[model samples]
Target: MTRSVYVTGIGRSDGRQVVELGVMELLTRQVDRVGVFRPLVHDEPDELYDLLRSRYRLTQPASSVFGMGYEEAAALQAEQGTDELISRLVDRYHQVSDAYEAVLVLGTDFADTGLPAELALNARLANEFGAAVLPVVAARDQAPEAVVAEVRNAHDAYASLGADLIAMVANRVADPEAAAAVRGLAERLPEPVFVLPEEPALAAPTVAQVKEATAAKILLGDHAGLSRDVRNLVFGGAHLPVFLPALTEGCLVVTPGDRSDLLIGALAAHSAGSPAIAGVLLTLDERPDDQTLALAARLAPGTPVLVVPEGSMPTADALLSLEGKLTAATPRKAEIALGLFETHVDAAQLSAQLSVERSERVTPMMFEHELVERSRAARRHIVLPEGTEERVLRAAEVLLRRNICDLTLLGDPAVIRKRAAELSIGLDLPAGDETPADPLSGPGGATARIVDPQTSPLRERFAEVYAALRAHKGVTYELAHDVVSDVSYFGTLMVNEGLADGMVSGAVHSTAATVRPAFEIIRTRPDASIVSSVFFMCLADRVLVYGDCAVVPDPGAEQLADIAIQSATTAARFGVEPRVAMLSYSTGTSGSGADVDKVRRATELVRERRPDLLTEGPIQYDAAVEPSVAATKLPGSAVAGQATVLVFPDLNTGNNTYKAVQRSAGAIAVGPVLQGLRKPVNDLSRGALVQDIVNTVAITAVQAQDAFPHGSGG
Candidate 1:
């Protein structure tokens, strides 16, 4: 099932739209893009959906969002029965859910529409949309006891209708001690229940909203100040001395424009930044002189000064009824809404409930998240050679924060520490855990450690080991001693010596610089004939594996078959189903070339070795990926389309194709993951971004889990 949540209000004034925006914030944090669906809306534009599209940068069209207006839905239900209405709603809902990694479904609102049983309708729609129901109950203006009953009833009502209840929320609760009284409902509910006190800022209107409501003219305003939230409205009937105390942060001062003295005092306070006001609302069509108005504009360059023809009393009534709506113009409220959610709701619990059984398609985000989760489950120690690199330090902080794995960073300790402090990365050992001395270190168990390769006590031991490994190649003891102090060599020796389970480097060095030590010291597994690399190409919707893109130069038919098998194992291990495609310039027997024969022979070898693997060979790139292209090029081939593992004939074609797709199609190529090694030793691109480094580290840690299942000492 698609991961989706439907947030619906049980009745009017629930103010649950904030919950939807908050959930969108969470979903976008998890995935790159999130789809929003509104089943039934009014004929007018959906202010909330517009806000979602603008703020979240959603690309869902109106055809998916405004499926059917309330009147149209009501007419359909009356004419064709509710079943037909539900069927069409489900169709429109799937249009969005299928396109996005995660979906947020906005349920039907019980506004002025004449539709009956809106709660039941929302429940049915949520079930049909395969969404977990998160019903919001408004507790404002009701007694604590009544609010408790309402929350319990809402949960039971949704659960009774076979709706998957995600969580229960009581929004805008009214009791003075509602925070204390919310315990009753919280304890009774089986799932997590949240209670949010009415926030005045979220319930207040912005300067732009007030201007629209009162039809006020902008005397002094800019685009920015017009978006400020009016936390409170103050009418300037008091003297200047008493009125200043009534002002609060984000307050909008209302006064007769003729009161130049009060207006000047307010602008002076605003200029001093004592209590920053939202904006000023001038009433009664009164005027400050030209000089004073110009002074007001200069005092606060972007602060708004709106003038209306109505009296202060009427303006107060209009402003009091208007509440803040989530829009692109109001980002402060979005922050506040997200804060409320992050503070009150258990994000981990919610995410666990939102998780569904894995489907056939593996998204890039899902693959990355699974890597982090899987690595963290069985922690390992992975060594990073470039400790002083800025991207490595940043990714180290993230990996430690996520508890992904303990890290060993190799460099000069003093330089690494100075740079890390400059970058504000905290790597201090916890209490009772001794920070390492200058040369050697503690085990650095669940965090990170900095090792100075030149000064470390293990350098001589590593020198002896390297001299033994490379003695046949005419390397002497003194030369091996100098070579062992290099960071990449030291880090790889750490992996070989069972000090760390895996290694990741190459951020500030060449790939050969990082991998040469691994090839020399660690060597390949006994069963493997050659060491090759595969890149996990993260397309927008799916993740595909492209093999030998970095390691091999001109592999023969046997080496190409080994690369395909290694790539299929890597893909399947990382949650991608590997339908291997031995890619060539030709499609089956369509063209004849030396490269085509090599790929054809490789495909035969793969079938002979692993008959269980679904594979096709001598296929073009389009035929390997696109179903329509496959239908024309190779009609009956099983792996013609939907191939997750694509093995190229040689390195030049695979590397160039991967780069072209990465640049043109905006795919993330996460490796060059070195395979067939006795222990996992991966390399990074010198130009890798911080996220790329993080992803690569996660991949190395997961591989380390397979190498060192019982912890660091393999």
Candidate 2:
């Protein structure tokens, strides 16, 4: 039987979407194939449905997600009675249930449904679907006793209707006494009751929402700025001194565009980190002069500046009507929501109650999650040379928030902080008056160490070490000293000298600029013969390892074997079983060429060296991946169609093939992760995004864990 949970609410404004999202998160963590079904949806597309599909990476089509439109369901219920409506919905529910291991049934919203017994309808649907019910009751603006009464009533209503009750949730409780009252009720009720307090940020309107509501023109700001929440509204009508006091954190300043004094003052305050504002909304559509606008851009590079035609009063009225929705675009709010849910609710107990079975196959999301979890288990410090890059700083914020790894950002401390401020990122630096034991301690107890290569005390030590390591290569002390000041060399030395566990660079530098330092300093492992690279190509269903993609432009038979062996080791280390496939233009001796012969030789070498590893060689791409093609081309081969690690004959083929598959098939290529290094030093693409940086950092941290089994310091 399919295990299903029905998330139903007693009334409108209950904020049940949070509970639904939280449940989905738990379900995804448990099962790989989780489906969502909305019994009755509006004619317009569902925002929450889109959010779940995007965030959870659901493959189910949108038409299959809901039973029917609310209007259609209402008409059916009216014409043929409620029995027929329930019958149709039950059939639709069964379709979703049969397809998935678990189904999350979203109940009807009580708002404007034109139905007199919406709660009873939800209970009936839950009963018909044979699903466990989790009911949410809104306690907003209610007293403690009223809130308690509402919870009891909601539970009884569902129970009386013969619904299979799993638990109860009291959402949006504002009063402290009400919150306490709900907690007390949890003990009295038969089922567990989770009480969540009102979070203003969840309800706060984003800059994009405000712009949409007022039809405002975006004069400045990027998508990142537009997603910022407007927690407060400050009218900029007073003098600079007086208006400055009203500037609160995440406040949206509303003033005329001609008020350059107020605009510049707010920008300056935001740059100084004195309660950084969300944005500045200019009324009357009056924009500042070009010079003033340029100055504002310099002050806060990504801060949103919106221009509206309405006056302040009308704009405030429009803003008051806006509310935040949990959509795919508002990812930060989703994070905040999940954090709140995890903090307040006992997720472990809830998951246990759901009884969702774990999946055996590893999905792309599961693989990514495992990477983060593994890295977090043994936290390692990773040094990033491109610290001042906007994407790097943003990635640092995500890394610190998730507690995945400690970071050492190599650059000028002041310049990094200034750039971070311009990007509206919080570095969590210590107070100016206080000095900490570790100079790298950031806000919220995360360590984000910043070091200037030129001024760091370790510069001379690094120079001496570099000169000693490269003495055979004719490197002089003066040349080593000059090179030590470079961020890449400095970062590599940190890993070599045991200051950091690993290093990830090359966001803005060339591949050579990033890897040359590691080659000179860290070198290759004792067991490895040649340095190589592999990219973890994350396809829709699974992840495959592609090797020799970035390094080693041309590998002879010996180098090709070394690359295959190294890639197989990397794949196995990262939870991918190694079924090595030596790819070529020919398959099973049907065609002969230099490339095919090289691949065949490499395959022979791998078999001779590691007989325990499953490998096939001189196979075409289609035969290596597709079972049907394998049956025709190379039947009875052990690793023909099931190869997890593909070894390209040379760099050109590997690089071009990985990129073609990535762009054409919508796959995420994680690397260019350099293998065979004595210490882990991975390089990022010059166009890496924030998540890319985060994933690379996580990968580097995991590699560091392998490098140092017993502790960080080698």
Candidate 3:
């Protein structure tokens, strides 16, 4: 079997080529027959892959390595579907995988935007290829906590999806803080995590890179000067003495072509061994006199002097935007990257893991990947009650890794730390800050804090608030104080207080335990008379929304209609087209019974309330899902077989059907997601796996995004 790794990033301009080169180094060392694959690319050729081919002497043809352009893939997806797009890419991947002992798959980098969609597509491609996911997190000058958080979340996301596990790397970390970041990640992450400090030499853009960016004319230059890493740019708008002082080593000097004085002064300084500058860029498409140019060249032999048509400001913009590339031309950068990777990572352990079965076993992919992508689009914060539970810890790692949303885990700080260390979760144990920084502001990466309800400063305040809210029931502050100490209550209070946008509980707790606090504190949205729950049934080909599965018991016709409306909205919000099926034992008017009548009436109510929705009711399960069954039983009905939202008559029917599909069909059921809440709060099954917790947490974050668009959760 071919051992493969998918190298990708969650954000744009992540500077992941270093990790890609490092992995290529690892793969070539492990096996002589190494192949490279890039699933999607922009219009231009990939510089890094070209470098790999030249350097590694790989025999695999470009046709095998390059799948298709992003535009081509998008066109295919529009014409066909994502399934067809992935199918072709998977076939392309196997061509390389079958021919090589080891393969390295590079992800896409578009000429433009759409990062969230691209990241999700990359993840799906990784899964369809059955490759172990290796995500490179860029931590360029971000806080130490953010760096570790990003790595952990990335690991968590892929790991929860049941992708073959590989270690994570936090690359391009600021050098001064890298050691501290490494030490902090020693205990929290559940997987092997490595930190690569930023290398200035590698980050410095070369004269060639600047020229490419500015489209300048190289008036006079040699290979050495052009290849020199440009560390800083010095605008020569000052006198000779003033500019001489600013002429630091590796600085790119930008001046008017006529500024022979500034040019000669800079090169004279370099000649006097004040460290060689990265050559001078002449602006306004002008050049010095031949005599002065000759003098400048002699002062620093073979110095690059380029001229651009743009003014100082435009040239400055180009220089500032340029970053060094690790192409075949820059073997030094490749060496530096490999050194960093080898220094921080255990290559032997990685090799052993690469030999695992993840490369050959492709699992079904849909809900989990899309769930995460949607939540990240508009970030929100969610609190988890069972902080010390292994499943919750793992789920938190993935959520924070993607910086999916901010998270607060309610539990004892020490226990959470110990448990996280035991599980090897890469958390760095986010400090018990009273409140986390805003995740929506930038990609700083989200984090989770372990707040012990017993000692939380907000506990008493929450108790008093709860007492006042429930005082009509004769609840006292003393009684509320005891209840608020429970993790579930504490987390819900966090949501109610706008401390967290939403809450996800019940990995170790019960559904009643999770939702009871929400029912009491979070309450119902003003538009809703009652709260309901829906399960997103992620079948192999599509997602089906199942409603009233875990909330209302035996709801009347009105409540059933409300569930249908809520479920349809939830389905639409999550990208599923809302074709509602009011489920019962009977189909249409084929049968006459009380249950069927209730469904028919509920469906009618749904149509009345949400006149825009496509709803059909009193439909059997087979007719609602299988097109063949729908055609025979309820012919010409638009929603008979195309239903994306299924509203059961009551909790018994919804809950049992969801579980049966979850167990028997091997579908991923993400929910019991509560709808019509003033704020977002959700529950998990006690038997929920790590992936289930991950899915539910993502759903909660997305819901929170909807609820708290204005503030934290207020």
Candidate 4:
């Protein structure tokens, strides 16, 4: 509740020294000294305690923070059973709290400190000592969210024990989204959340990455900024045979005749403006062509272009020999491009499918029996707006027929029937045609009267509110009439009142037109700080998640974190634990700024808040999938080495990055998977196909499962 809070008890491992230091530095201002209580201390020298003593400036017994000064007693005591271990741990906390202001409880390397008991002891101690309680979640090679969840669970246990939760610290947040998600969760929590970003490991070669995938020499024009690992092979048109050796070794950019202006221009544009090219190869058949040489010099003043004797087919063949070296591994540029392609083609295919047209593209998550079972248990409900588009009608029918969702169609029964008939479909009417009840008439109409009846204390409250609503300028009788008459809005009301599950619209209206009413009437989820969108990408070989694809503009770290959690959870619903990678211009600590800082801060927050999620970031798209690149940039980061979900920094980055990946990577982008809604509702593009509708419906069904387990619509 306060701007800042104190933290105390924490267990530490050998490598956790930096973690301890970073945490203490961040929290030192919030409270005086943090009681460092741990289950065990192993192989730690007296100097470690000396450092801790100096940092907190403790004058009391060294055991106050070090728990017996790293002696054999500490090691032997740490191996004891949970109950005894916790009993001593709690006893130590009370003794320390007499001097310190707050207790920052630490968990073990894994959740192995008998978490439940430790939390329980902390709670009892907090009550006895009258000190605020903070839980520091530390993990080794675990997902950020998972760790956060464990911390939260422990915190919950402490809270149940009657201890006040001051804040939570997530140690070793490795990704941008993971951090953001933790931060976001923290922002929404009753207490503050802190995440500690992982430090970079070592710089690995971009050239090595390119060379391992493709047998092409790294050719630089006049500019030479590419990584050193990229091999350089001078190009000469006449010496085709010589270029052959270079071709089999690495990535090669063949320029026009060595003295040509075109080659220089291409090199300058590519090397200076984009993904660093490995090297440049220039063709040279004749010695002195003054004009061509001058042009080359002007275009690529600093690039090192390899010169080789020229002959078209032979030169091309020399380059062809390197084909065997080129693997299918995707580069960052290629990955980003492919994501775009997948999104466009997939969205188009889905759009057509929703309209009943045959489509080649299948949604990432097909409506299989297992998924359906989940849906049945979850009981997702979907709403069809009034006067249904031909596609919406068909989609609803298919969903009901397929048992994918509890379908609700808003509009007059007769009108809907009429429309259904026009579309060659049958339907069961909910009401007779001539009822003509004014849904907006408040307590005057039969429907209003039906709602106004003797509930309890809120009956008059509802009546008054309805009357006042009608008086409000925006709540025009016409608009109110439409809301009551429109089945989609009406169905949304059902969801709001616990009668239905989810609502979908936008086929016959704009996104704003459909969402405005929901935002105004239904409200956001209880813990949700903001609303955002995600795109589920199913590539030929893998599934990727991209977010803020349809919502949020300049999201701060907190907002990005929310988007990451929402996206990760959505991905999990589709059967992926969602190793989320927070994307940025630079990988690891290669860059800096508020944007980079925000991502770093968010990653820290998410690690502290969710801890259960695997995430790493400030990573390039390439680093998300390429284990080799990840090894270089993030080293031991679990997510950076192999990420499945990617949270972009902002809308531009998210949208453009997704589009680029889909388009160039040949991936299928399945959704603008909306999150934080009450039910499994989704939007349809104006030009959506029938398959798109079916797929969207399927996704909604899954969401329904997530929202309401056991098919409870309410």
Candidate 5:
């Protein structure tokens, strides 16, 4: 039978979706194909189901995800009895279960179901479906003893109905002590209970929600900005000096559109990072002039400026009724929800209950998931020299929100802040002592360390160090001082001086400009002869490492061998098994040329040095990756067809191959991750996207973890 878990809530507003999402994440991590089945859903579009489909990259058709709408189920139960209703639902459930290794069954909501005994109905369905039941109880606004009693009662109710109870959860507990007390009380029960405290951000209204409630026109802002949470509401009617102090981070400002003074003042405060406002709500149906709108756009480019048809009082009333939801559009909330669930829930116990096994094949989603989780496990500080770039700043926001790594952004601090404000991204700036605040504190608490190389106190120290390191190579204090002012040089120095664990640069800069500083300051590792780079080409089914793709132009035989070794080591360092393939225009002894000879020599050197490595060489591209071609050319070679690490003969072949595969094959190229460095410093392409920056930074952090296993310089 397919393994399954049924998530049911005891009452409404229990925040059970968190548990559902969390369980789905665990299921996907363990199995390649996990299906979702909602026994009963509303007639409208299901936000949670859409979120699951998009986030998990589920291939199942939407029509198959749910058994039936609530109205249809209600009518069937009223006319044909509950057993007939359940029998049809069970058939629908089996449709999903038959296709997937595991299935997640979302129980019907208790609100307006018109059922006389909803909880009993859920228990019966779970038992019929052969699914282990995990019940969620809303503990919000309840006393500690009451919360404990509710959990016990829910467990008893499910168990008495012959449902296989796996675990229980107490969600939305307002009082921390009460949450703790409930957790303690849960031990005496039949199963484990996970208690999650109230998170205001999850319940706060999103900008999009506000727009929907008030019928507001979106004057400015992109989808990203519209998804921001409105944690608080502020009415703006006073003068600039008086209203500025009232601003709070993630608050929506309510004022008339004619009050450009208040609007501009709020934007200025957001720019200064006093408190990052969520958006502006223009009341009374007033609209800003074109010139004013243009100014607002420049001041806060993506910040939502909304115009409503009602006055401030009515707008406030509408906002009060709005609540944030976990939807496809609000991915940030999903991250926050997942983080909360992972932090509090006992994943080990849950996995054991579900009997989930680890997946053998690593998909692209799995690769990205592992990278983020591993980087978070061994935290490291990574510096970015292109801090003022919009994509970099946006990627920084994602990194900070995900709690992936500590970041030090090198540029003019003012410029970085201004750019972040314009982008409407909340950055956690360093405190007075140059240390990041606790990332989990709240908005603006996970800021990156912003450093201006020109004004920083470490400039003199870095200049002196640079001068000492290069004194014999025509360096002086004046030249070192001038060079240290450059963000790339300063960032590289930060890595060399143990201030940062690693550095990722080259966005909006050339590769030479980015890595030149690293070569000058950080240099290559003592055990390695040369520096090379690799791109983790994330194909549809697996991740392949491509090396010498961005650096080492026209490398000789020795350099080629070093590249192969570095690429293999990198492949193993990541989760990929090292099966090296040295590529040329020839396969086996089929061709003769300088290029083929170089590759043949490199393969020989690899065999001589690392006899334990699995390697094949002097191979064409077709023979390296295609199993049919490999069987025809070299049938018995272990690494011929299943090559995980491909080493190009030179830059021309390596770079072109990577790009062609990336564009034509729709692959996600995660690097140009530089290897063999004394410290980890990776370069990015100038056209890298936000996700590209995020992936490179994560790779850099993982490299740092490998470099300093004892948590050095984090």
Candidate 6:
């Protein structure tokens, strides 16, 4: 996607320089198409554009998605009709958009204060063509809130007219705190926040941010979260001077321990107010000695301290995790520290993972539980908890009245009504017929005849078998026998046919009771292997993916390999790069036997199968980390340790292991988020937390998007 902005008047040359520089930086990061447009240029096309075009070999005539060749654009003024002028601008926008993924419509400086009208036209055009509009607000030393307010007003105006504003890019941010405050203020607004830190383009931390994001807290001192303008410095043993000056405020420093001079220089620069001191983290694993402590005390006093035992913390593999991230915020500060931590989190790493723009693709499918949300338009049976509390019953009542889902209860309708009335909780399930029917057949009605075995769609699909069954004189009875093994038999039938998209049961049944019918009838996806589960491990920095907690037995090396690959693929779909580690009781080559061998062999197989994947195996939790240990054991393996996606050899290890990690390590498990399904189908724990329900729905939607990439989830 590419966006090009047009400008007729920059208050001054410096203003023009700032505007062009900021615009180019933001656009280059976000889009592939970069061009400029000026419909009625009274003067030379902005000098900055010329400089950029000349420097970058960009084409000229300044043709943009909105074609405003200076000659014809100048005639628009002499043209009598306003509608005609607007129509031409709109047509040009369409032409430009066709050639690009997106177009940034820049308003012109119509000398007669026609800038607003031009902007309105641009907004209308953007709305018509579905372009993301991000108004660029240029300011210098202004109140943070004022800049935010102006951008928000413009955003609201566009949104009110049926357009979505992606974000606002502030030009010439001078104060670090004010810029941070501006970002903070804008996030509170309905729109997303994108801040351009004040720094030279050559010194931006784009690469470092990418590394931080991909590594998922593997590296420290990458504070791209606070500053958009962070540039890496090329240095050897002695170029600390150049590096120190270029270190903008809030920039993260990632240097080797042997490069003590650079570290000291960074600390000295921060001491001198060169920029904001985000945090300083040592990358090596050797415990801090007197010298290291002294240096850290002098340079990073009170700053959050983190040590990544990943030996040398510069690898291309670690940087790929940032493939789709839009901002310079490092994964540590943005996602891990701030996004994960509700309050004050580790400041040292917060810059790397500070929350920024997430994936923009909207999911096409709803969760199994969310089916009730569509009840208003269709008649359906929804299963609720058998012994639901008053609050839950009341909520169900509201849902029923709103047509969210057709209410279905397993208990007697009369008893349910009496209870609901007694507790002041209303419900519609109580009004339905309470009479029990035959298990094999459905509700008695004309619909029953439509479900005849010979004339049914199932008959056509299973014709030979049906004929043979008829010959046997009792085969249909046998097929119908498996229909209702429990009280929720009718609900299972909805899932069998496509009458209902899915069913949510198990609030009152055991896991076996809830899943047996599904396994017998609904069945597993055709391509799926053994069913498996993964918990949505919500950690401080990013979400952790744990698997096989609910299914699978002692998976062989191949099964383990498949689990790793499937988990990694799922993580990628969710915008997370997988660093898979096939965990065993042993670390390195210390232990032998089927278990360790399985991990070792599986790790190799995963690498061979998916050359693009990052993985390691037979690694102890500590050795996979603790850089000192990793360096000693696996001298030079790419994914020697510090793995993110942990694949256990069997369900026993996967289940028990994740539970221990949660209880002992204080990690919150968001799922047993099921994986390897054809659709976004998830099984709920009997005692599910409310947040779990919400997250499952979100995951279901995400999976639905994956299942139906073309928006055909329904």
- Report the C-alpha lDDT of model 1 over 1-714, residue by residue, as the tens digit: 468889997789898987887677657646765788888888877888888887655667777776788889889999999999999989988888888777898987788877888889998999888888889999888887788888888988889988899888888876866655666657767888888777665787778899999999998978767876777788897889998888866789999988887787887777765566777889999878899999998887778898999998898899888888877666556545654564566667877777744444566766876786687688788888898897897677667655677888787766666455333344542222112232222222256777778778888888999999999999888999999999999999989998888999988889999989999999999979999999999987889999999999999999999999999999988988989999998998888878788899999999999999999988999999999999999999889878999999999999999999999998899998999999999999888987788788889988988887777653
Q: Please state every model's RMSD to the true fold in angstroms.
A: 10.5, 3.7, 23.2, 26.9, 3.0, 24.5
Of the two candidates 3 and 5, the one with more favorable TM-score, higher being better, is 5
Order of models, best TM-score first: 5, 2, 1, 3, 4, 6
* lDDT score for residue 12 of model 3: 66
What lDDT does each candidate get?
0.82, 0.86, 0.78, 0.52, 0.86, 0.48
Q: Residue 479 of candidate 5: its Cα lDDT?
A: 97
- lDDT, residue 70, candidate 3: 75
C-alpha lDDT (0 to 100) for residue 139 of candidate 6: 50
lDDT of 4 by residue, 91-133 (tens): 6756766655434433333224323444454455455545455
Q: Flag the better candidate by TM-score, 2 or 5.
A: 5
Over 587-705, each residue of candidate 5 has an lDDT whose tens digit, in order, gives 99999989899999999999999999999999988898889999999999998888999999999989999999999998889989999899999989888887788899998999999
Candidates 5 and 6 compared: the better one by lDDT is: 5
The digit string of per-residue lDDT tens for model 6 on 1-714 reads: 343343222222113233333344334333344455433344433543454554333443455523454445536645655556657766766666566532334445434433335556556656554555555555556777766665566666666776556555455567776677767776577655555443233223343343444342422232322223233322223477666666654444555445666666766665554543444434554345567657755664443333445554353234322222222222211211111111112222221222223223211111211322222223333343342443334434333333333333444444555444333232323233442121112111101101222223443343343334344555454565443323444444434543333444444466566555455445666755656667756443345567667777888878778888888876666545577777788877789998788889988988899989988778876665456777877767566545556677888877887778777875556556556654334555666643344344345445544454543212
TM-score of each: 0.62, 0.87, 0.54, 0.43, 0.92, 0.40
Off by over 4 Å in 4: 1-370, 412-415, 426-479, 482-488, 663-666
- Residue pairs clashing in model 2 are 428-443
Each candidate's clash count: 0, 1, 11, 116, 2, 38
Cα error, candidate 6, residue 645 (Å): 1.2
Model 5, residue 701: C-alpha shift (Å):
2.4
TM-score of 3: 0.54
Return the lDDT, model 2, position 531.
89
**Model 6: how far residue 578 lies from native, Å:** 1.4
